[model samples]
Target: MKIRQKSREFIWGIYDFADTIFSMNVVSLYFPLLIVSDLGGKDIYVGLANSISQLLIVLTAPIFGIFSDRTGKRMPLFIISASLCAIGTLAIGFSAELGAILPVVIAFIFANYFYQLSLTFYNSLLPRVGPESRWGKISGLGTALGYVGSIVGMILVMPFNTGKIFGLNTFIPAGGRIATFTPTAILFAIFALPTLIYYLRDERRSKYPVDTVNRHPFKKIWETFSDTRRYPGIRRFIVSRFFFEEGVETAIVFMGVFAEKVMGMPDSAKIVFFVIATTAAVFGSIIWGKITDWLGPHQSLMLVLYGWIIGLIVLAIFPYRWLFYPIGCWIGIMLGGVWTTSRPYLLKIAPAENVGRYFGLYSLSGKAAAITGPLIWGTIILIFSGWNLFAAYRIAVATLAILIAIGTIILMPNKTLFEKHPIV
Candidate 1:
């Protein structure tokens, strides 16, 4: 039993490793560059693509959550959404090859929507992976492995762009930015197979069973929205998450573009920078996971938020080429810490029976923030386009810093709110 459970935990974590490959390579790094630099599009196209996909996720996430809760199943949905996400990602590569910006954007939007949608089901699987006491460590392990995936994904995909693996010339034809998409889609599908197979075979039901006969997903969404008042800190936490996630999501979408445009880093240098940053994130996720266990997720999350506020401000004002490495490392650490703490934090505060619904709200909060955050970033960039381009990008970073600061303030009072919940 112990070995089986441990295997289950590891397999669950592999999915994190799998999905993040798509996120790091496609969403965060290559796709934006493909849009703006290679295809002659603007920042707004990238932002709009992200926002549109997020809007679709936000509209449907709650309903998806309610369905998961009612049916007491997550794996089938996870597999279906994840498979579609891979297909969509492959379509992106094909569309880009056609040399049409609109097709690339359309494919990206399709890929991103399913990618985000899959996370709604994926996140709710946390409780099934381990006992509640181990949730923090387990979540951390998954996040750490995810950063590792980012590192590996970057290295694996680099050959496509550079035509060389580890500084050696290779026969693999360098297709530049366009070559990145197909392999990324392939990796996403390959790595995801383990978890999909594991869950399909296990066929276990959730501890919290719901009335399948009296299903009312839409009404349940409303009821869950209203029922948050009963959970004490959840409403406040979600609200706070909305504000901070806006900053985080915007950064993730624009960071690659910012590195290229503002810092004038070449693609190879940018890859090195991200690897260093992602390494820091790997360590940070592991350390912060322990901290979440020791300090409790709420307190730990506050510390992570404080780190974001400070880091974003420094990142905005000081855009020196020399400082970019250290600052990138800092942001990467906070990025790992944020997700590491937030997942268990939600699990800690909410009742076990409604985990799916609340995590849906969690996804909803983040996706809603995602919907506006990129648009806000694009608007800021557009508004200041007439000015120095570098200055405009810096100003956009400063705006995100302010948003993180506001989220910190709102989250501060939640130390007391947790006291009202019995789980705490």
Candidate 2:
């Protein structure tokens, strides 16, 4: 039993580790390039897809969360959603080969919707992984492993990025871009498998029991949604997180496009930049994991927010390929710190039995802001047509920096949130 429990914790890291494989390689790195360059599409398509996906997640995640809470089970939804995400990703590669944008868009919608749903279920599992005191370390371990996965995923897909298959003698002329999705899907499935299999059979007794009175899942979800005022600290934190996350998600979702249009960077260089950033993220996750436990989640979040503000400002000023090496590292560190700190903080203040619902709302806040960031970035690009491309990216990033600054102010006076969990 002890060994099995330890294995489950390790598998938790595997779950996170798999998520970034698709996130970095497919979504952040290749998809934007495919849209703009290969399919001759606009940034607005990317933005639309991103916004629509978030809208789907925002509407559906809480329903799923309420279901998990009502049923006292998480594995069923995890398995189904994750498997579909992999299949959807694989379909993307095939869609690219067919030279059809509609199929690719549909596949992206399928993959991203399930991808967001997967996180809600995965995060709800965090509270179940161990004691409350170890939440930071556990979340950090998973995030660190996630960055490591990002590095490995990027390396595996590098050949595809360059249009070269290592084993094949011939290159597929633009094949690398489309071929990337297949291998990424495979890698995601391989890492994600252990968790799915383990949880499928190994049901430990539930620490959070189902409520007897709440018979309808939708009713429970509605009540939870309406009762936000009861948790003022969480409400404030969610609002603040919404702002900063807008900055982070915008930067990440469009970094490839920015690199391509602004820096005139080749596909290979873009992959290298992601590798550098993800490597920095690994260290950031480890360092901040400790800080999360020591200084608490709120303080750790503040530190990362400061990093975002400074990093965005510097990148806006420079916006050069050569400079991205250092600038990417700064952004990576903050990226790691954000996920590492936020989850433990949410866990600290949430009602234990309602963990899934709260995380659903947590996902909602981020997704709600997520809808705006891509739209904002894509719209800014449209608004600045024929102007200096780099300047457009800079202005967009500057906008993000201002949002993060406001978020920093909102997050000030953390006394209320911290009072519940002093050490976090």
Candidate 3:
């Protein structure tokens, strides 16, 4: 029984490893370069594409969540959403090959929308993976593996873009940024199979029948919002998450572009930089997971937020190109820490029976921030376009820093939220 349980947990984490390959290749690395650098689009174009996808997720996630909860099943939704995301990713590569920027952006919007939506179901699977006591450890292990996936994904996709693997000659010729999309899509599908198969064979049907009576999606959304008042810490945590997540999500979308434009880093150097940063993130996720278990999720999350505030400030002010490397490492650590702590933090505070609904709200908060954060970034960049290019980006980074600071302040008082109802 213990071994079977462990296998389930391991398989669950593998999905994290799987999805991040898409995130690394498509979202964080090649896609942005394809849009702005290769296709002669602007940063705003990338921002808008990201924001639009996130907007879609924000609108749909809660309903999806409510539906999952009502049906008492997550695996089927997870598989369907992930498959659609993979298809959309493939479409992106095909559209990019045509050199029609609009089609590529449209494909990206759909791919990213499904990709982000899928996470709500994925995250809701946490309780099923382990006992509540082990949630932090399980979440951390998944996050660490996900960063490892980022490293591996970058290396695997490198040959497609540069025609060289690890800076060596290879049979695969350089195919440019478009080459990355197909392989990334394929990899996402292939790796997700283990969890999909496992669930298909072993998942038990939910005892709860689908709630057909509450058919109005908007009313369901209203009830869920009203339901949160009964859960003490959830509202405050979600509100705080909105601010910090905006800064974090914006940073992820723009970091590649920022490196290219502000620091004058080449694609090869950027790959190396990300590898180093991901390595730091791997360790950070593992360490912070232990901290979350030890210090409790709320306190652990507070520390992570503080780290973001400090890191974003340093990134904004530091002028030297060499300094960017270390800052990337710092950002990566905080990045992993945020997801690592935040997942378990929500699990700790939320009622188990309503996990799906609350996680949907959790997704809503993050997606809502994702929608606005990129737009805010794009607007700031446009406003400062006439100034020194480096100065424009610097000011933008500082703005994200302020947002994180605000989130940290909002989160501070919630320390008391956990004290009254301690996790066992």
Candidate 4:
């Protein structure tokens, strides 16, 4: 790769690192606790909020994708999305003073919407940023850095969360969860700055023919979905992915809640658990990324899915708190494996001309998982919480395990996924 292309990769990797930091610290970890504990909200709100954000992504991401394709510009849109995310997060920090759950949820939803929406453009950049042969390595490096960011973000926010650093007393019913949000916004903004500034100079613009006069964006997205029949391999993989991703999203989104409600862990233990898991993830991404490139996505994905099954089963069945330590390590490995393998698989299979649109569909399918996973998990929890909290969590996890199994079974037959087969 040339120097400029390599630089883009490095900078985008940092961008992903910062993005993951925000996601792990705020979305996957702290936000749920804040809503349920600090804001005096219910556990179901965690799922509800996630489902709503993803539904919004499903509705709007393709529109943005199509628009970027038409305009032949992605960095500009990414810059706007990043800025909006920061503003929205700040709004959430302030929403605590409003003393209403609705405002805080709305602000969080806004921030999360842009945060996820921005990735459509980011994912599109991958095919253009570096050589396809090295895409797996680049993605793995980014995933590894992302885990490092997760660790750093966790450490950075620990002081405020425990009321130990800077003497900041932003507690709810006394003050608010501002300490968490304020620092998150600042960190996200600072980390995102380099991407916004450097990305503009990179020349990874859209290569597809620009449809300057295209109307009916929704219809265009629909037509693109209809065109999937032309690529059965990609189609089958995506459909299988939709089911398994539901389980993945649900489990990750609710793991913190499960730790609190079922394991009876307090905030301190939760932070420590995530740090250790994230440390494991850093290694997982590096190791599995090599495996992905060597064995190809199909074999590598199968290995990770099996790991996921074992992890979920262990989490559901193990009764002792001491068992969770090793379980967390296993979950981390699978988490890194799933992401690092799936994208390269898509890149290998997808037509180069329509990378943006296909990845948009990819985002949509992921958002579809986001919609179903949380809704299913929340509904199960609500139904069974009446009977027993632990039962609800157990059933929900089992449901995710079943979904993963189904996805794995569907994908198992696609050994020739990237090879052309007669469409007859």
Candidate 5:
């Protein structure tokens, strides 16, 4: 990572562009709401569908990474993962069966699986992408570009009122449902071309040849588990990430729900909420990346986590929730910084050769505990007044605060100092 290089950076940036389109299409802009409102499913059902996706990642991404490292060819896996996700989006767009939740659920589950796996290869290429001095900056900038794609995709899809595109009324498939997803699907396919070109360009520079192996995939998987504990930094960061991410998932799972049900936000304004938050996160990633270089990872994370805590507090405390526009702004900032910066720190600490395997470990640890945060909030309502909403929301915020505090203490002691300054 110490040597300067942008060939990989420029190439990988193209993939980020593609990935942003996919995340916007599936995660942020269109799909989840389509299932809930147009398809007549419960919000909990949406969570279950995505939870299944993450659960699959918990089970499979590590195996995928082990294979990726053993094989050293990333583009094939990247191509396969992105294609499956795009095809899954196409299927979701065409599905009209309300009672056939099984198909819809399965489509989303597989889409997310591919989406998450792509990252295993993407991250494994980081050392080739740029200098160690610039990893934080490049990673942050790439993430910012990705978020820009999300915002732009949302805006593009916002104007299409018809059931068709390219003179095809593909939005309405069956059962009186408007299953349109033309907006980002085209973007996903088109934007992905550049990434393919880039990865193919660089396949031979790094570990592109497959490794010699006689052991089973399961044996390789066990080897990864045995290897992870030997690195204390990776293990600690994974544990800290799990606890802090509980709060992240809690807020994300319920933000819009709280807006419409508790804060009495206008229904039309919810998408606007998404656009704003994501846009903010885009910039926050850039800003925090610079700061992470300057202040070091531990200090930067502390600041970002505090911002997250305040964002949660404002979400719960303000009587006229609309008055918290500033909070929303900060939430965008903190979201970008928290996620993008946190990652490069792990990349910095991990052993140089095993990035793929450790990243798989990263996905497994964070995602396997994905249910803990949401279930805690769900319990607040179940144990208190099932009919009451806002009070339980406050409890969720309180719980998140505790998580942030505990993580800060554990994180501070293990912070890595640069040889000279924290940044280049």
Candidate 6:
């Protein structure tokens, strides 16, 4: 990477790190457990609640995307949305008392809405800052660093229950649940601050800009949707990724549960598992990103998918907690490439003017799909406590592999395919 590009990637990575903490602490690791284990909500309700939140955003995000497209702005949306989510995270931690499932639920919905909306706009910039050749590397680096944030946030919070820097002693005894509550809130606020601050001051300008927010948000939204109709490759990419992303989301978000509920693992074990995965992701992202420069995004994606699929299969068949390291490492590698590779790849297929609109739809599919994993896996557990985390993981991976295979067959790109019809 050139010095200038490296500089942009660094700032971008910082934003990703700050923002990804929400996914790490609130959505993936801590809050879901807080809801299920502590608040006594069933997985069905948990899943339903999460699903609805995405659905809510799904309804309006494309409109926001269209507005972003019309105005050719990404930073403002990212700052506002991420800030909202950061605040909501604080709201969530404070709502964690035993009797306040309702409050927690409300806060969760709001947090997801803003976090996702922020991502829709954040992703719009993928194609803008970096060279097409280096898109994969750039995106991968940002994503991997984002997961690193997850690792840090979760690690920081573990002291109360787990003891010591390495142990679960993060909590200050007398602070009780409030202690946990305050730290998570403060961290969420602190963690997301960089993203909002940097975005507000960044000097980058969109090549496309317009005066009006969509006069007909829905109709204009449809226009944004219809714009993609001309691109067969983009369609296939969406369908393939709709499945691929879910497995990634499921593992990152629900692994904590799988550790405790199904695998009988401790917090320390969960921390170790995620930390290993997080570390692997950091390196894997760098490697995959570089590969994208050499091989193109699609080839880079295929390579990562192959590694990811193999890992899923291994975990399914082995079903051993000890194997989490190998499997986690496998995931970490491919995991880095997913958002890193896909968004940039999709941008290559989209229209420059519609990056926000299309990316919004792109993110929508993944978030909409996200609700299913928790619901299905959680329900399966309710029925069969004997079912292991590995088995559930296998199912998720297998489903995605099938989707990827079918989509690959339909959308196989031979170099010239994307050049003539860039996504944006």
Instruction: Give the candidate number with the greatest lDDT.
Output: 1
Q: What's the true lDDT of residue 368 in model 3?
A: 92
What TM-score do all the candidates reach, one by one?
A: 0.96, 0.93, 0.96, 0.92, 0.85, 0.87
lDDT of 5 by residue, 1-424 (tens): 3232555566576677777777755664355555555565555666666667777888888888777767777678878888887887777655544446667767767776787777777767777777777778877877787777777765555445333332345544322223335556677778777877676667855554344664787787788677767776666777787777777755665666556555666434655666777888888888988987777666677778778877776666763566545666777788778666777778777776667777888777667656566556556645554655667656666777677666656665555543424322
Note each model's CA RMSD in angstroms. Answer: 2.3, 2.7, 2.2, 3.8, 4.4, 3.7
lDDT of 2 by residue, 116-227 (tens): 8999998988877778878888888899999999889987777665655333434444456887899899999999998777765654544456644565767776787677
Residue 28 displacement (Å), model 6 = 1.8
List the candidate numbers ranked by lDDT, top first: 1, 3, 2, 4, 6, 5
* Residue ranges of candidate 4 with Cα displaced over 4 Å: 1-6, 165-177, 204-215, 418-424
Q: For candidate 4, lDDT tens digit of each residue in 1-424?
A: 5897777777877877778867887788878877877777776788888889999999988888888877778888888988898888888878877777888889888999999988888888777667887778777877887888888877777776676423345343322245677778888888877777776765453353455657688888987788788866788788889988999988778888788888898877887888899899989998888887777777788788889988888778873579887899898989988888888888888776667778888899898999889889889988998998788888888889889988888887777663332121
lDDT of each: 0.89, 0.84, 0.87, 0.81, 0.68, 0.69
| Candidate 1 structure, TM-score to reference | 0.96
**Over 4 Å off in model 3, which ranges?**
205-215, 420-424
- Model 3's C-alpha root-mean-square deviation from the true structure amounts to 2.2
User: Which portions of model 6 miss their true places by more than 4 Å?
Assistant: 1-5, 160-163, 168-171, 174-181, 203-215, 383-424
> Using alpha carbons, what is the TM-score of model 2?
0.93
- The predicted structure with the larger TM-score, 3 or 5, is 3
List candidate 5 segments past 4 Å from native. Answer: 1-8, 97-100, 161-180, 205-215, 374-385, 416-424
